[model samples]
Target: MTYIVAYIASLIVFGALDAIWLTTMTSRIYRPVLGDILLSDLRIAPALAFYLLYPVGLVVFAAMPALRSGSAGTALAHGALFGLIAYATYDLTNYATLRSWTLQITLIDLAYGTAVAGLTALAAYQAARWVAG
Candidate 1:
């Protein structure tokens, strides 16, 4: 039950936050920089796969461990590191291979990803605590 709560909370918080960021930034950030490479429409399957899978990673790697340790700081720290590494893996790869990818985009994504993941982990930790009690 506690782990379930943590997983759901992580999913909801991260999903909601990232949805807002993607919708808001698609025009202002992504399109401006990646317009040439941008598809006319988003591919739903890949997006759904990523959205669904990422929270599981967060749950196992960050939230679950923190929940076990009973430490919110652990959740946040691990989650942030996870986010940094995950986002960097994607953004840096793009920056390296794609002609249009930029430092600004990579840096911005790193910041947002780290912040959101940490916040999601904290939220998940709190939710798990509430459920366990």
Candidate 2:
């Protein structure tokens, strides 16, 4: 039950951050002619990312046997991996929609991805700790 609560709480918090990050970051690169459509869709990214996390969460769960083994760093690493994956997938899908994928542009994209991962991972770690307790 605690685990469930933690996961849910983390998802909400991280989800909001994800949306904020996406809207702000993307706006700098490409202004969507769809107006509010991007914001609406951005909200969905968190849940989408979380869904991806399910498989990774299984790994996290399995590692639970190590109990005292993992740290926030571990979560961050996992989250970073998720972010990179998300970035690649997103970039590929939106390439046509984007203006240009310059080096600076790519770096910015990566920054946003990293931000999402780090923030979410931290939230998840804290929530997990609370839940585990």
Candidates in order, TM-scores: namely 0.96, 0.61
Each prediction's whole-model lDDT (CA):
0.90, 0.57
At residue 3, give the lDDT of candidate 2.
Answer: 53
Q: List the residue pairs that clash in candidate 2.
A: none
- For 1-119, candidate 2 gives per-residue lDDT tens digits of 54555466556766677667656766665554434434444466876875557434523532232224557666666666667666767765565465544456556676777666655
Show model 2 residue runs off by greater than 4 Å. Answer: 32-68, 92-103
Inter-residue clash pairs, candidate 1: none
- Candidate 1 differs from the real structure by a C-alpha RMSD in angstroms, to one decimal, of 0.9
Top candidate (TM-score)? 1
What TM-score would you give candidate 1 relative to the actual structure? 0.96
